[model samples]
Target: MTTYPPNIAKLFEPRPRLKYLEHIDIAPKERSTPAVSGLSGYLAQLKSYDSEIQYTPTEGPIQKQQRERRERQRVQQAKVASDLARWNPSEDPQIQGDPFKTLFVGRLDYEVTELELQKKFAGFGPIERVRIVRDQRGKSRGYAFLIFNSEYDCRNAYKESNGMKINERELVTDIERGRTIKHWQPRRLGGGLGGRHYTKTRVWGGRTNTFGGPSGPRSVHQTRTAPRFGTRPAYSLRLGPTERRPYERQASNERPERDPRYGGKYGVYEKYKDVKTEAPYKYESRDSRDFRDRDARVPERREREPARDKKEDRTTRFDRSMY
Candidate 1:
């Protein structure tokens, strides 16, 4: 009899017995039994185990990590390529003419330099030129124009830039098609001074001259001389107080009085007054005393009176034959 260790014997502890009668005298297969198979299989497996299966080297771990990273990058690149293929430049037609020459409005970053702007927009397409309208001091006015080689590029730029907020302000991109051209015209300075009334001049350094200097000639020292008109004698027309002009005063006085004949103080009264006073007008009331008295004085036609029978007597009869 082969004696087994207690740990191995626990695998084959008998509980219920089988009563099959194929071969009563034959012993059970030793290799097929749990006690014999369990320990023998473990021993064979341990003898065949390699040390590489137990631990991986540092380089192997690094290579596995790098493989995972490369896979992620490839996936990202594939997605970007897919997006680029779907982008349509010609579906929305570009604005006609040179895009770089076109003006734009509503930029956000005033401090953003031209190079920075170009670089930012270059992601959309090739930028030809960028101009920021500035003050005399060359400070940005929060608006700028970007030009591109193609209209498609401009359209893309407009799509990307419009309503783009920078420095807390939203950009408003537009095409400046109808901007008015401004010309620098020299202003006439002395034109205001020559009028009959001494017109007020924009005083420059205490001078009454409209241009504030000599009218035409330039001094040898290049300094502007005082205007000659200031020294010229001005004629005065003096009038005594209460010197009432017969026609002027009457005309002025009669003009206001004539307004009352039409109606009241305001011009509105004339319409109401005409409707009340005018005869043969539809608005004149039939119930008025003037209408009643006029109707009473005019005799009624005898033919219009109620007819009486021949046998009936007519009282207070007047002669109809009198013309």
Candidate 2:
């Protein structure tokens, strides 16, 4: 018979029934006292049940994976934000002095919107956002602003998008200026009292008062018309076939005499004759009939004195003869 340690036998006997059979058999076999029973399996089952029944909570694999994913996303977002803040255009030699990170897209179709701008510029790099300018009526103003995630992307998009065509129109893309621009307004060509108030003025005899003096409101009676002869300069008359002397413009100290050749000696009568003529007052010429009226004013009154003698004496001659 052989004997084994209690601890060694405990290792070989796992079941209670197996331990009992080992104790009953004694035929030239290695035998020993069974130090332990099959309580380890029961203990494992109890441990599992205890864990299930306990109040303390535990996360599953799926929940643990989801938490890890959310943490990673948060960290990535924070890193992106910090990078944007720390990015210095002055430090980058490639950026030069122009630190603009926005692209000014012009000549865009009137129908193009914010989403179209994003779709077109996104291929260049990561875009921060897109903004399309609109008017007071909520219509697209045919331009947009594209902001990128980095300076390189901004420059790249600017270079590549220049002269690019969309909706059959070539686009003009450039680096955005740092200043704010006023919204575009159509130039007002016609408005107020100055535009529609223009009258079609006709200048007569090739003469206009355009450069003469300060313009005053013209009355219907103030217009002075030129003579039918011509309006050539007085110097030009010297060059004509008539070869006249240079007209000497002298100042007169005495009042000019009214000749019978024109109208009459009376100023009022002369003006009345001028007003009855077709010519303007400033250019009225002498009339042949005016000379005939000059003699008729005086001798015609002496001839009218005989008319009174004829009427009174005709009746008196008969009465005197009877006396």
- Winning model by TM-score: 2
How does model 1 score by TM-score?
0.24
Candidate lDDT (C-alpha), each = 0.52, 0.59
Model 2 segments more than 4 A misplaced: 1-99, 180-323
Residue-level lDDT of model 2, residues 1-323, one tens digit each, is: 13778877777776565443444667656657767866767888888997789686799999999999999989877876666566443454433222367787887999887887788788999887687878889999777778788989998998888888888888888765433232321112111111112243434334432332345664322332233334423222112232344434444655466555664566547667745534322214432112322344443332222122334574565564355
Query: In each prediction, how many residue pairs overlap at the backbone (N, C-alpha, C within less than 3 A)?
Result: 1, 0
Clashing pairs in 2: none
Residue by residue across 160-247, what tens digits does model 1's lDDT show? 7777666676767765432322221111211111122333354333333444343555423233222433322222122112222233
The prediction achieving the highest lDDT against the true structure is: 2
* True-vs-predicted CA distance for residue 266, candidate 2, Å: 99
Q: lDDT, candidate 2, residue 137? A: 98
Kindly report which residue stretches of model 1 are placed more than 4 angstroms away from their true locations once superposed: 1-103, 179-323
- Provide the lDDT at 245 for model 2: 46
